[model samples]
Target chain A: MTSFGNEPLFLGIDGGGSKCRAVLYRKDSGIIGEGLAGPANPVQGLERAQDAVLACASAALSDAGLSQSQLGHLIVGAGLAGVNAPRTRAAMLSWQHPFAQFYLTTDLHIASLGAHDGTDGAVIITGTGSSGFSQCAGQQRFLGGHGFPLGDKAGGAWLGLAAVQAALLALDNLGPATSLSQAVLAKTHSQDSTALMDQFCGQPSAPYGQLAALVFDEAAKGDAVAKAIVADGAGYLSNMVLQLTELGPIKVAFIGGLGGIWQPWLSDAAKARITPALQGPEVGAVIYAQQRYTGEHAP
Target chain B: MTSFGNEPLFLGIDGGGSKCRAVLYRKDSGIIGEGLAGPANPVQGLERAQDAVLACASAALSDAGLSQSQLGHLIVGAGLAGVNAPRTRAAMLSWQHPFAQFYLTTDLHIASLGAHDGTDGAVIITGTGSSGFSQCAGQQRFLGGHGFPLGDKAGGAWLGLAAVQAALLALDNLGPATSLSQAVLAKTHSQDSTALMDQFCGQPSAPYGQLAALVFDEAAKGDAVAKAIVADGAGYLSNMVLQLTELGPIKVAFIGGLGGIWQPWLSDAAKARITPALQGPEVGAVIYAQQRYTGEHAP
Candidate 1:
């Protein structure tokens, strides 16, 4: 009935901190349909991530002009955020997903695959969080991306956090009173240190990530503290990029919301090895499904 | 009726991150009994804090050989952690407490009160958390103690967090590898960065605070990174002490579990300003109750 006989439908999903993206594909027709949903990182919430995956899958099927029952006919590849944690990965693996076949991996892995278009390469993601992954010579290496507060250096959340820290120290007269501090105070609409601190107490990284742009804005205006923060972050990313490059002569693709902003700040050597991503992570997920499915069914 | 003519029994409570402490006192007999209970920081949990307060109060009454119904006869003073946040304070104040009268203030306030023996002075608390409070010339000033991952420099949690960050950087080869990193890995039983990060993910400040001694231990052995961390924290505290002293000619007392460990690290000027607290915070709570009660009943 389909364009090609005995060809299976492939569903690729990229689940991240804020949203989940899905693509329904067939070998004969490329991507037939796509769908989107919200907050599918298992580290944030396991049940919520699972629900988003199923919902996006169904939506993708519907968008492809197919019935919901076609979900069971689709082979799926999912790249989810927070699955690197052993416990989170286990919880996800226990999921009774609705699909003919399922393959799961880290969001970084999918991003890398898609960046190089299923070839060997490295990807540096600088969104709400930061991390690097490289697959070369049949080996994979992970760098940075330890999560917020503990790590995730050069990330949006880290930039915002550094700005807040500088502001608080200046407010207490323990650190220099820079324009960056004033900028942070103005951005948060906080009249004083107490108000500023209160706004961020017990908060997750998303709220901090929201403040990251302020740091860059102030730095561009030649704020010393802001510049220092940016330099430190960029230095970390440069080091990460260099380390990822050590896994061979693989091209490193800087991707994510803040990726473009960080590009110029990298070292000249790091910049030299940079390349544009071939496709989005959602497409990488599909490639993952196809590879795994073929590997399993091979003679 | 009880001892001195018509004098009421005073119950003083110091509610903190890990435990609640209570002291029962009377005009004729000072500190007749004391009791301790579990964690009572309202920022951590509202109902749990309330329950800990009640439990500690009940235990104090029992220790003083009084019946549970005696809860209604005692005037209470509670100095709780996190009450500096208006929301946490409002929630705590709304408790339907079983006491003849309830007086509430921040733990820092009572610490300052008790440290100076109800006189004008300053107190810096460096424990599982950190804060500075000074009462002088009919005015009160609050400093630092912004809570973990935000502020609280020189606090145990801050020290531990800095160590972890250093260790992670070293493991990633982004920073110089020091004995501090080796010690942290051994302490956490982690073979690499992933395990170290895993142990601290989504963890509260208390767990990090537990690792603080490792920093001090390594610093004592002349580890450059550990020493730098200590110096940075001490510098912040030194500045805080100088600011508190600027309020007036006030004696500053370093208080809390880690207070003594940090004392020798402070600047000579900060050291010169330091004095020993005359009493613990629980006793300070009683002083707070008496001061409030006398003020209310006067004229």
Candidate 2:
């Protein structure tokens, strides 16, 4: 049998479209190390994520003074890029990794686990993408956020995409004039649609999601356009929660940028519609690592 | 070089999930034919739609007294079950029959075209499913509606799916006490959740969308839960419109069962953001047919 590492650290990761993170737990079940890096989207294109995951993991591992062979039962529960899809899954599964006993899944699933402290609950994850997942009696179900150009309505990408449309509409004098143009202009320092196009097209890596926040902020300040988006996003989320809870009793949690913005206004609404138990993915990862790696009673 | 049908009989057909139609065009260059059928999901299990199309077209043709060869050009455009995607595109393209020339596209694309004569416009088709499409400057773009389990957020299926959840939530006392219980009771003619469950689980022909409509109608009459759903649906449509207009100046049009119900209330607000264009697929097909079979008249 394999032995534990030098003081052996268990690991968990929340690998997302924009970022990937790793959190280390102690042999005795306490938090030890943490590291963050750029996107590890193992499905779309795995090279970057593979390199990044390995490098990030090593950075965290190096910080903990442990080598790959030193660990026992790594139990890396990753929220991978395309876990719901077999092609993505197959690609990710084929990722050239040397991990020992690695467990991979969607980021939303891990967020669900993290949000409910590894218990029965549902989580709506909205980043560049959006997804809803629930677990009860060890059964899991997912709703929405299929992929880009098709699904993932009411997420950061959805909001960002809306902002782009609003900008285009205003440029063409198609819709009611709004400040989105100014916000995008300021964001890109561009004079007209041509410059804006360059930023989206040419790219020093423009943050497409940056505009989603502007829309939310503008909506909060009473722009009808923005208000429509918030109202729509809440509905998208509510719809997701409704589907997730179809299985059985459970709490609900929100994760991602839009969640952070809508949380206060939505808290009461959520209480009426969902159960109360909730938390975050980072904390959830810690708890998961403890239960799966360090013995439950290990001190 | 081609002769027109003397009776001025024209037919317009909109086929997809939840509703399918064969409306004859009778007025000079306008719609006159009319027939409705079941789900003609081309991506679904079989060849029923091809037969349905031929039968319905024949019926319309008979009504008009237009022989096959004498007809100017029987331009047939279809947005069927399997046409929304790239993989299905080849299959859809290959389904040509004798019609001078036939055009096949996604129900989403054709619906958008039908709504506004295939101009730069968008359509939120919310029948048994929901999807959005926008075409501008001779290019097509799509958003939402990946599939059923991955249903577009804020759609008929989403609404139908949400109503079921609310009813279930009330069953376990996990949510507010609402009339959904009574609504469920009224639909299945059962007193409690058990009877409803029997229908819900029975043979899968319960028309779950019917329950979603009850939620919308009650909301119109001031039911709290129902009102939320109506506003929620309106909000989602707004977001979809925004995304569709991303390509360029787009006049959005709504279609499908839930779209019809919600269109009136949503019109002013929707028009505020999108230039709401009125027309449907039948009109679009005629317009597309004119361009394809005869000379360039601009679509």
Candidate 3:
């Protein structure tokens, strides 16, 4: 459990649009500490995200029983939410940490690193936000996730939005008939369809994304509409990976909230969209821990 | 123009998995008499569908003074592509007519009907093959087309049997990722990552599903480990509809090669997945011509 326990201990963090995940691992690649915390808004603002990271890091430190100053060196890998902006990117680079070294990157990069075991591969992430990223020959790239208006096509948010639309169609009599109508109505506990409209048109977008799981549940039970939602998501997501890989060779992988969530509702084609890496994103995180540690001090 | 004028008229037909639409109106609905066409299977089984009722009764026919009995009705709204066990349902229907009806169904029901009018609604056909149907509600229904192994999902012959199991992980070095992988590779151009052991893997699956587009293109794109192909198809198609609805309130329709194409693709939050009406299937064919004759009568 000590940093000097025959080998160094490294920290790998995956921070992105929605949530941030961090795991403490041995240089030899064993998990020692793991911590999960609130959503760290990296793009929108950094103050909140910094606080989240501090809280998560503190928790991990406590779990590992090591003081920050006692660590020999630390490798921090973060795939942040909105680091796409210059200001955000600069802010990430400017953050001076107590650790010896840290690397901040887009969430997709870390996710891919974790999934591919650090080789050239791609990862399609579907969650509150959705995107696909590929890293080949030690370089990174991506597709989709421009924004809710422009991208984020096949994320959980997308699923939720489809559910809302289906619910509304059932309400207006202008859409395909689906059981998703009843389920949506039940979500609000609304006695009528009119009330359902208020829920969707009534609220802003971020809140609406919360309803995606409802569609997933409905699809799990064989609702054609709901299944369509997931299927469509699979199509969009897989296409992104395909497009990203257009750059070079790819051994693809799925790594995200929606990546592993498709077990119950995955269709035959979705399973064929990307090459499943032997390890999930979490495992990717551990691999990242080892890679970053080695990369920093490769003899 | 009088019926005795002896001039052939242009006809619009929409054939889908659910229903067929035939619209024949000569610039007016007052004389618009609609005729039913049994399913037209010129594509699937070539020139005839088993269950298809190829009835061709145009609203113009009722207006035509010549009720010629020498020729039977010409049906156009059957989704042929060698549809499953054709004539199973067509044999049950009665076809009584004195004129020939030109067939016009291409599995792109809404687009052919709605696209020409400027309404852009996308359709994914999945009978024997699949296509993307787009109709911009009240604007145009432009079709992206149903390209094999790329554009379709979840229906027809390909999906039902492609990945029965072992789809979750396409373990190349790990021994056949999943049954889904084996199924896809066997049915696809490439039989899994390492090269197919069987030379005749694609025997049963002749006209590959649109999911193949993801695979074939992904392979071209270097997603050799791709297992998310199906999910991508479904998600992207759904997003296409989302984009359609984003344009405006739509007559989002789904009638094509497969009953489950849009479901898998429409998983995006931005998508507007519509459940269509149960009214006459080929009613669009009549409506197509009707809308042309009268501004009203088209979705």
Candidate 4:
């Protein structure tokens, strides 16, 4: 066993809209413990995010058989959602963390790093929201993480919104009735258009994301409306991939809940650039910490 | 001047998402007074809507040189937005109103009544939201009006959302840059995609509805993206008109802020069935009160 004074311990955190994850690690032994907690997106709630970050970090220390007092002895690196906004970033940077050292970055940056195992590459994320990010020759580019109703085309929430729109049109007899519409009605437990509208009225993107699977399933079964919706979303993602590729020769890795599902629908050129992710964003956070620490401590 | 006791005073109220309008009427004097107040949609706030209703009514009485106590003698007919929702309707119905008799119905219903001067007809409304309503042969039919994001296609908010989506795509280099995109960026004071996204993040339908005029202006200037957006929305509105016409031989009257802007884009078939509205929704509420009072007193 490495003594506390002889070897430094690291904690890596990946925080997002729905949940926060932390991994405790050592250079010699790799991952020693893992932790999970609720939402940690600063844009949603700065106080809640801070609480979640501390909770996950504490859980990670406990998981590694360490005491909470050891927080001051450990270095921490965090990749958090919504930190791309300058205000949110500033707010997060002001957190009075309990770590010996703490580093922060946007979730997309860490995600790209993790996809390429701390090397330069591109990543397309299609979870509840959609976005593309790349780092090549120390230059970074970001595209299409605009959120639901305004942007985020090809993301889960976008797909769900498209499905609901089509289903409603069909129900109103303004558009053709299809199996996709039927499935949407069934999945939402809505007997008619009014009920379906009631289900989504003034709702956020999460609930819409939950309905995404219905689109893929119906499209796979040859529903024209579903196929059209999928094609439109996939087309946008494919264009995003092409746009990202223009930045550098970096291989692109797809990540997030709907990432794998979108693979088959991408253009041949987009598919050609696809690669498997080497690690998760938590590992990317650790890599970020190591790089920052080395650069700051260099002679 | 008709004495209040000799000629019963009738108050008609048209309460919508943004404002409430009241008209004081009598058979001998016609419209004698008018009043207006803000945001009276019960779905947004029951208490606020109730207060606005009373405020508008009090203003109408004051305009007509009547005391506040005269409310107890005035028969009121109200056509309110959001009363279509059963729960909101029930809550509104439960209010201990000060009027002698209060009859409540949906804004769409009153609009249709006023458009046809209490005769049977169909009406299409395209404001911040969209909907179609027709009353013919003692049967009523309603369409669209599902609200923003989920539905409300062809409405101001829907048109604005489509424009923003196109603008973001153009900014990201995934779609062609056009005058529509340029206008959106300029109107929102956004320098780039990030800034544009920031401007609309978590915004409600009202802000988006404000952008509708941009689409119309760009489309008029022959911008392809804007034209396409307008075409899609106009197609939906035309389809809505066709669907409403299927119910009966009723002439359809287009109403609301964007109603006239959408006229030139509608199909010839839709255009053939269009007619000018004879009166506003507040007058429809008066007609409703007259019908109800006459029916009750007839035997």
* Strongest candidate by DockQ: 4
Report i-RMS for every model: 1.4, 11.8, 16.0, 1.0
Q: Whole-model lDDT for model 2 versus the true structure? A: 0.62
TM-score for each candidate, following the candidate numbering:
0.91, 0.48, 0.47, 0.97
Q: Tens digits of per-residue lDDT for model 1 on A89-152?
A: 9999999887888799999999999999999999999998899999999889888888889989
**A11-45: candidate 3 lDDT, tens digit per residue:** 77766545667777765547777767777767656
Worst 10 residues of 1 chain A by lDDT: A1-10
| DockQ, each predicted model | 0.60, 0.03, 0.01, 0.80
Q: How well does candidate 1 score on lDDT at residue B294?
A: 94
Instruction: List, residue by residue over B148-262, the lDDT tens digit for candidate 1.
Output: 8888888898999999999999988877899999999999999998899889987888989988899999998999999999999999999999999888999899999898899
Clash pairs, candidate 1, are none
Error of 3 at B108 (Å): 37
Candidate 2's docking class is incorrect
Candidate 4 chain A minimal-lDDT segment of 10 residues: A1-10
Regions more than 4 Å wrong, model 3: A1-7, A202-207, A216-224, A227-231, A260-270, A277-286, A289-293, B1-299
Compose the digit string of candidate 4's lDDT tens values, residues B26-83: 7888998899999889988999999999999999988988788888988899999889
